[model samples]
Target: ARQLQKILKLDPKTEVFLKRVSLLLTQIAAGDFGGARRRESFEDRPPKVLLKDRPELTK
Candidate 1:
């Protein structure tokens, strides 16, 4: 709507903006915005200091 476009300061990308908003709502409904999910996705790699002490990297 024109009111939404005026409020959002968008030229004619209301459809695009609506699509993004829908996706955000979907993510919220699916609990994808939780911090626990982010923490669980961390890589289980060693620290940089330990990597430097390795025999392969020391060579």
Candidate 2:
């Protein structure tokens, strides 16, 4: 955060906003942050393939 503040020359308001976000992340484990989120991965993932209708490319 400090590095960003220095590099971006952030205004006071922006600095405060970043600090709030950092604090929120630190508190996520304690339920202080809003909805919790985390990454998940499947070990036996299926390989990607081209679909018949190009659904993968569109959506």
Candidate 3:
């Protein structure tokens, strides 16, 4: 948090800085930064005609 304050040129004692830190902490407590997002993958095979013989392209 100190590093981020330094990077943003924020004074630690100010209201704006305190509000931002509070919001960030609240978001973190709610798992907003957790790496549990869905990933993009081929749910089903691509159209056969578009990639008829390109074996490597399937993935």
Q: What is the C-alpha local distance difference test score of each model?
A: 0.72, 0.64, 0.67
Comparing 2 with 3 on TM-score, the higher-scoring candidate is 2
- Supply candidate 1's per-residue lDDT for 7: 84
Candidate 1 lDDT over 28-53, as tens digits, reads: 89888655755665434545786688
Best by TM-score: 2
Question: What tens-digit string does per-residue lDDT give for candidate 2 at 1-59?
Answer: 99986879978899899998888778886775544332223223323444444566535
Off by over 4 Å in 1: 1-12, 34-59
lDDT of 2 at 21: 86
User: Model 2 scores what on Cα lDDT?
Assistant: 0.64
Per-residue lDDT of 1-59 in model 3, one digit per residue for the tens?
A: 99887767856567687898898798789877443441223334466876778777776
TM-score of each: 0.38, 0.38, 0.34
lDDT of 1: 0.72
lDDT of model 2 at residue 6?
88
